[model samples]
Target: MILQNKERIVIIGFGPVAASLVEGLLPAVTAGTIELIVVSSEKHLAYNRVLLAELAVGATRAEHLGMVDETRLRNAGVVLQLGRTVKRVDRSRRQVLLEDADPLSYDRLVFATGARPTIPALNGLNFDPHSEAQLPHGVLALRTLEDAMNLNKVLQGNGRVLVLGGGVLGIEAALAMAEAGHRPVLIHHGPAPLGRVVDADGGTLLIRSLRAAGVEVISEARATGIQKDETGFTGLVTQTHGIIEGAALVLSTGVRARTELASSCGLAVNRGIKTNEYLAADIEHRIFAIGDCAEVAGQAPVGLLAPGWAQAGWLAQYMLSTPAPGPADPSLHDPISLAPPSLESSDVLMLKGQGLELTAGGDIAAGLWDESGSQVTVFADPAEGKYLKMVSQAGVLTGFLAMGLPRTSAELVLSYERGSMLPADRSTLLRLDDPGILEPAGAPGPDDQLCRCSGATHGQVAHAVEAGCTTVAEVGESCRAGTGCGGCRAVIEAMLKTPVPA
Candidate 1:
């Protein structure tokens, strides 16, 4: 892989992956080795799609959603082409056709066009441009910041808000609407809320949380059609029940990869644009795909910020390492792959290698266990929505489960990962006063997930810290640990404060 004097790189879709790739390639860009061109179908540059619900509720402004400033990209010598959709990609000629502009030839082309919301094809669900049925007036889908802004305008006054799907997005949207003083009703075809990710017990806990937030959750209910009156959407017709009246309907069903452009251009497509481990399409070596649009080796796409960020960095490094470099190492590691998706029921258990141990089932109930597998103590209060179970052997805390509070759980997991002996009194186990509870002197376990958002383990953090990351901010900036929810900040901060063995 040798680059000529004027090698051009064109990246399609200015979402997280593309934005991250551009940012990661800044050093090479400054050196004048590469000319980068970013093409986005959206009028705006890269923005954070993860917080669309927050934007919908007017909690954040549209400008705040953008990931990077245009001036920064311009400073890095990257060309920005916005509001122009790619018409087609001619692989044989290595060119990309834009909607209004001339064809652009590229030495390397990247397809990072993200996924789109899957609006179910129901009867009479057409968008009426002339009437109030159009978005910013009535029904809307929360995907982009523009969509959120449009929805916010229509939801000024109080009205019935029907939320379709009980997934994370749907739940978040429903909660946002309810919090905004609108009556929100959630309808899901699944048996329980967040059924795909959490078990029935966890789902029950989540449902209780939603209901406490004034959200009406109706599980095992499917929407068959949209009921619209002379004014606009009046209600939604269910498969089993009769019509449920509502002022507006929001669809959070799910999304599919936006592969119309790729498929039309004769690129191979399975569920998404099929790519190898290096995120390169099997057909064309010069072309690479990332983000939600690219499926690696038939694995279900993670479709999160962490994986996309990793993909971008690795892809940029692979592309830049040419000429003087030997064969580029195509092997890429995504820390997010280790962390469980929030929707999955995978239990983040803390196990004691010895006799005493505590296990918290998905129900948030903690159960104490002994070496003989005998249940010693069970602490659960479904009514109060609290569960704390602990297991011990030989008068020492072996295992524990503190559900609903992941920060607390993570602290306990870290304690267990370090194999620290618990205090004699079981009540003191929850207290963080003891310094010995921290990961054993300098031995940070590899399996312990340090960055909860990206599922980066303790070993990964230690490795990054050893590689010149002296501060938590540096570690976060370099590896993206405390970037998302900031839940792992305490643990990362504690590690940074603790002195390593001499």
Candidate 2:
């Protein structure tokens, strides 16, 4: 679809995806090629929902989490309509009807309405007083930043907090509440905490960590109902056990894709709005879905912020450019695969090229293994909760995983990928610290995979430089490297200025 000058684009949901799209369209918006309108049910502008746990712990203020600056958005020609919900979409007329406003027509409609927290049905349970509608004052579910702030206010006074579910959000909330000096009791029907994302061992480790942090965890206990008293919440009824007392409850059970608008408009709805590889919904040609609302390849929404950011970038590129032949390549879009958090404990050994050259050795668990039979070693302590694992075989480093250490892993991985020989001993490897390690070596070639997250090879980046791709953004556009975690960005820039060896 060719976007004409003065074409109107209306976006629903003023969350991360929508904000990102608007920020990306700044050039087009400034040039008067597109007119944009963002409709949000929230009263506040788009904010970072990923940091809600931090908000709960009081680490970050509520206003600081906003994804976009309102002034910047306004200056870029985006019309902000907050505190309004889209009642219905009349696709035939190409207009969206808001709850209290006249129908607004659009040249293109983008569904970034996002997902809401899924509050399960329980008997005799009333919504919390701070809830949006006051269905009951006994149950509280957090999805929005406002929800987190309200829950934080309610949790201020001394009271028992029974957090339901043991997923990432639940664990995060439980940890945050515990850190805030609130005694939180976690209930999960699953076998362990973070059961969906992490493996059994990793979950066990996480549960142990939470318990050490003073959280009472109950697994295999499903919340069946809630009992309330005149003062507030009274008790929680579980399937396996009888009722347990509680002053307040925070439900972190899970979330479903917010598809009310899509379903109401008669779009193909499964657990989420089904989208092709390009993130475009199967029903609407012009409309697309991204972030938590779109389901790709039957995978349940991971709800992590990074994947959503990647999806939004890809969608923006596709929307702005001509239609490419065939289905959109999944390889082009790097959705982080849902792997269990690594919990290995073994001694890490590294070999760069030939001879038993020792780079950095550490203790790692046996579980974290590569395709080869060699076990990953971790030099860092698991008890202190700082771990590093690096894998190498036949005088070459294959893979490395480090939780807290940043440049160590990046340097080691770069050395391995470039087939550079490691320092003779552990002391030498450890002594060669940060800024020095990033310096280009005379022997090693520049075309090494410095960042494994994006599979960015130095050669492809060098080629971009030869092709007049002078800036990092230009290189990213040309080769799609250094775009994921961006940890190697500084290294890439450093390499650009260095001269090649004869």
Which candidate leads the pack in TM-score? Answer: 1
lDDT of 1 by residue, 1-502 (tens): 2246757888999987788899887877878988888999888888767667767777777786666768977997998999987888986666889889988888778889888777765666643321222332356678777677766765765677788887666876787677776678998888786664444554666567677777888888867788876767788888866898887788787877777777777778877888777676733356788878887766656667666776787777777774211124233323223222122212343221111122342332333332474334443456755445555555444555554433345455555545565555545544332344643323446766666455577777766776778787678667767655444677788777767656
384-440, model 2: which lDDT tens digit per residue? 543444555554555444433344544665565555655545234433343557533
lDDT of 2 at 409: 46
Residue 51, model 2: lDDT of 62
TM-score of 1: 0.74
Evaluate model 1: give its lDDT: 0.66
- The weakest ten consecutive residues by lDDT in model 2 span 349-358
| C-alpha RMSD values across all candidates | 8.2, 9.9
CA shift of 489, model 1, Å:
5.7
Off by over 4 Å in 1: 1-4, 126-137, 229-231, 323-379, 387-408, 411-448, 452-478, 485-502
